[model samples]
Target: MHWVFLVLAGLAEVAFAFCLGKARLATGSESVGWYAAFAGCAALSFYLLNLSLAHIPLGTAYAVWTGIGAVGTAGLGVLAFGDPLTGPRLFFLATLIGSVLGLKAVSA
Candidate 1:
């Protein structure tokens, strides 16, 4: 329930980040749509995050939410936009994910 909302919020955060990148790279009318999508996703992400916060601790929820978004966005960038996934970058991303998992395990 709450976890689901948190996960969705994190996914929305990824959508927002992707839309932002697309908007920046787009031209003319395309940029407008991208910006609009970015705004919508950002709003949805925040709303869901707020909902989850009602149940989860602030620090734990926030860390996990951001962690999911960061990993998801980076993965998407690599697959969709040809962003580099160098060794060090992957290692650090894994570390972040581990930290997030650790936080979740320690939390109630």
Candidate 2:
């Protein structure tokens, strides 16, 4: 259950990042909407994270959460915003994934 919360929080973090990116590309009311979405996601992410902290270690949870957010946001940027997906960036993301998994394994 805590793990589920953690994953959801991480996904929320990604959503917030996506919202921010969209907000940047928007204008007037559209940008305001995106910003509102960002705020909602951020609040949800933090609330879920706090809930997960009841069972998960702070360091592990934080790392995993940010890991998910970073990888997910970067992937979305590449797919939606024309961000470069270079070899080095891919390599690092893979490494970050491994580290996050490693933390989960050890913490569990």
Candidate 3:
């Protein structure tokens, strides 16, 4: 259950990053809407993180959260925002994922 919260929180973090990117590309009222979405996602992410902290170790939780955010956001950037996914970037991403999984495997 706590892990679910953590995963949701990480997804929310990705959502907020997406909102930020959209907000940058948007104009006028549209930008406002994106920013609002950013705020909502950010709040939800933090709230979920706090909830997950009740059960998960602080360091492990934080690393996983940021790992998910980084990986998800990078994927979104490549798919939606035309960011490049070069060999080095792919390699590093895989390493980050491995580290996140390693942390989870070692933790309770």
Q: Model 3 over residues 42-96: C-alpha lDDT tens digits?
A: 9999999999999899999999999999999999999999999999999999999
Tens digits of per-residue lDDT for model 1, 1-108? 888899999999999999998998999999999999999999999999999998899999999999999999999999979999899999999999999899878977
Among these predictions, the greatest TM-score belongs to 3
Look at candidate 1 and tell me the lDDT of residue 56.
91
* lDDT for each candidate structure: 0.95, 0.97, 0.98
lDDT assessment of candidate 2? 0.97
Off by over 4 Å in 2: none
> What clash count goes with each model?
0, 0, 0
TM-score list, all predictions? 0.96, 0.98, 0.99
Our model 3 lands, by Cα RMSD against the true structure, at 0.4
In model 3, which regions exceed 4 Å deviation?
Answer: none
For model 3, the run of ten residues with the poorest summed lDDT: 99-108
Candidate 2, residue 103: the lDDT equals 94
Give candidate 2's TM-score.
Answer: 0.98
Candidate 2 per-residue C-alpha lDDT over 1-108 given as tens digits, one digit per residue, 9 for 90 to 100: 999999999999999999999999999999999999999999999999999999999999999999999999999999999999999999999999999999999996
